[model samples]
Target chain A: EDKVVQSPLSLVVHEGDTVTLNCSYEVTNFRSLLWYKQEKKAPTFLFMLTSSGIEKKSGRLSSILDKKELFSILNITATQTGDSAVYLCAVRGGTSYDKVIFGPGTSLSVIP
Target chain B: SAVISQKPSRDICQRGTSLTIQCQVDSQVTMMFWYRQQPGQSLTLIATANQGSEATYESGFVIDKFPISRPNLTFSTLTVSNMSPEDSSIYLCSVEPRVGDTQYFGPGTRLTVL
Candidate 1:
């Protein structure tokens, strides 16, 4: 079975603080790892990490994958109240048609 | 990325009844996935609906309980059968674009069974 585990199930931080969320996976033939942000409805795509040691960034949110360690981390710098949401990590296996295995997610709350 | 939409954004159904949720995508997609999100939980894959074949269900899920239909590359439906309180959840439909691995999601159907 493909499994993905996330650390720090929940966190509380103030604005301007930085936070790092971790995700580790155990899957056969690992293909790619992705990060998503969910506020209320649908999850918004964040980053997709396919190669190790390479950082993918979009504004204040950036993520990097460590294939050697089978883990990934999402970093939110200068966090704002709007950044408070659930961060989800998902992984896809080789030969799978985008069938992603999702982690339990980390709930973040940013206080103003 | 593709735009996805789901019908019946929410509903409160009685036990023993069933609800069918619809999903429509703006463009053709190769894979459509159904997921269930229980309260305060992560999304669980229910099945993978292909264009011309039977949907492949994941472990702990069955066709009898969650019948799915994929009539074409741009549309699909998921029906929750024999509803119980346990069936109450947020059902989301996702589509992976033909050009990328990113999976876009619909607004989701929030079903609340009493």
Candidate 2:
């Protein structure tokens, strides 16, 4: 079965703290890894990593994938209360249909 | 990224009833996916809807329980038949405009079964 696991199911940090969320997956025919930020309703797209050793960054949020290790990490530098949300990691794979499997998610609480 | 919208943002229905959710995309998409997220749980894909064909359901999900229709490349619908309290969840519609593109999500339909 395709599985995506995340570490530290929940985390609490004050403003300006840097946090790192981890995502590891085991699937057949790995293609791409994606990260999303879910606030209240729907999840918003953050980054998609398809290659190893290369990092994708956006302002305070950055992410990188390590295909060799079968994992990815999302880093948030100088976080704020607005960053409090559920961070979700998903992997798309499968040679026949390309199914996307999602992790349980990391609930972040950035206190002001 | 594509813009997607769902009808009846939320609904509260009685048990044994059924609700059909609509998803509309601004641009033509080849594939549309339906997902169910239970309270505080991860997203579970219900099925993949492709135009001109029947939807392919995921494991544990059947067509009788969750029937889907993709009339065209830009619109689709999912009907949750015979709802129960356990069926209460947030149903989201997503689409990837093109291959290798990020899948964008709709606001989602919040359904609560009594």
Model 2 bad stretches (over 4 Å): none
For candidate 2, the docking band is high
Superposed on the true chain A, the predicted chain A of model 1 yields a TM-score of 0.95
Task: State which candidate has the highest TM-score.
Answer: 2
CA deviation > 4 Å runs, candidate 1: A94-98
Poorest 10 consecutive residues of model 2 chain B by lDDT? B95-104
Candidate 1's residue-wise lDDT over B1-114, tens digit each? 898999989999999999999999999999899999999999999998989889999879999999999999999999999999999899999999863588889998999999
lDDT per residue for candidate 1 within A1-112, as digits (tens), equals 6799999999999999999999999987888898999998788999999999999999999999999999999999999999999999999883455468899999999999
Candidate 1: true interface contacts recovered: 0.77
Error of 1 at B51 (Å): 1.1
Clashing pairs in 1: none
What number of backbone clashes does candidate 1 have, counting pairs of residues 3 or more apart or in separate chains? 0
